[model samples]
Target: MKATTMKTLTVSLTPHQAAMMQGAVESGGYASNSEIVRDALRLWEQREEIRQMELARLKRAYDEGMASGEGREVSADTLLKELKAEARSSG
Candidate 1:
């Protein structure tokens, strides 16, 4: 990839996380602390995108369920029944 424009950032980290990033750079897996930070930011951004998509899907499902006029009431028995069904399917 071509080197892109730069952004300056400064932040503090826990000792353990700082050590881990330093070790990763020293281990030749990353060229510099900036590289490590950029990679981490990219991964976090991807995760945020995934979470947003999941939330949108959930909202759509909730809206559709409401439109279907299914009972919105929940009781202990209903919760237990769903849990039991999940356990049975997994086991």
Candidate 2:
């Protein structure tokens, strides 16, 4: 595997946060503070990507519903019954 290019960053940590990083290094859990920061950023990036995908899905659903034209009001119980009937038939 090829290594990605790295850039240096200056970060400020609270006393507790600084201690946590130092403890991890002392315990051999991480090679350095940079590794821990990189891991955190990777996780944050993944979460942001998932959030964006979900937002897109919600937007599509909203657009589809709006384009579907005027809607009729149905009772909650009636809707539930219809949904259950559909599920049973499909299964």
Candidate 3:
């Protein structure tokens, strides 16, 4: 496959970060500094997406529990038994 065309971009970073990026580029695994930045940005974007999905799942569960109108009862034994059952099933 043909390699992609390169473009110039300017960014600011701390000295340590710059050193790390320069080291990565000098390792010869990345074609340029831009390649390293692009890879990191892609990974960050993917992780952000996963975080958003998890947040949405938690929100849905909370809303469902609220809608169920279950009275709040904090019996420690009951909670422990239910938690153990769930852990057993999951693990």
RMSD values, in order shown? 4.1, 2.3, 3.6
The number of the candidate with the highest lDDT is 2
Q: Rate the local accuracy (lDDT) of all candidates.
A: 0.93, 0.98, 0.91
Q: What local lDDT does model 1 show for residue 78?
A: 92
Instruction: Identify the candidate with maximal TM-score.
Output: 2
What's the CA error at residue 17 for candidate 3, in Å?
Answer: 1.0
Which sequence of candidate numbers ranks them by TM-score, best first? Answer: 2, 3, 1
Better of 2 and 3 by lDDT: 2
lDDT of 1 by residue, 25-74 (tens): 99999999888998999999999999999999999999998899858678
TM-score of each: 0.72, 0.79, 0.73
Encode model 2's per-residue lDDT on 1-91: one tens digit a residue.
9999999979999999999999999999999999999999999999999999999999999999999999999999999999999999999
Cα error, residue 41 of model 3, in Å, equals 0.8
**Which of candidates 1 and 3 is the stronger one according to lDDT?**
1
Shift in Å, residue 16, candidate 3: 1.1
Candidate 2 regions with alpha-carbon error over 4 angstroms: 1-7
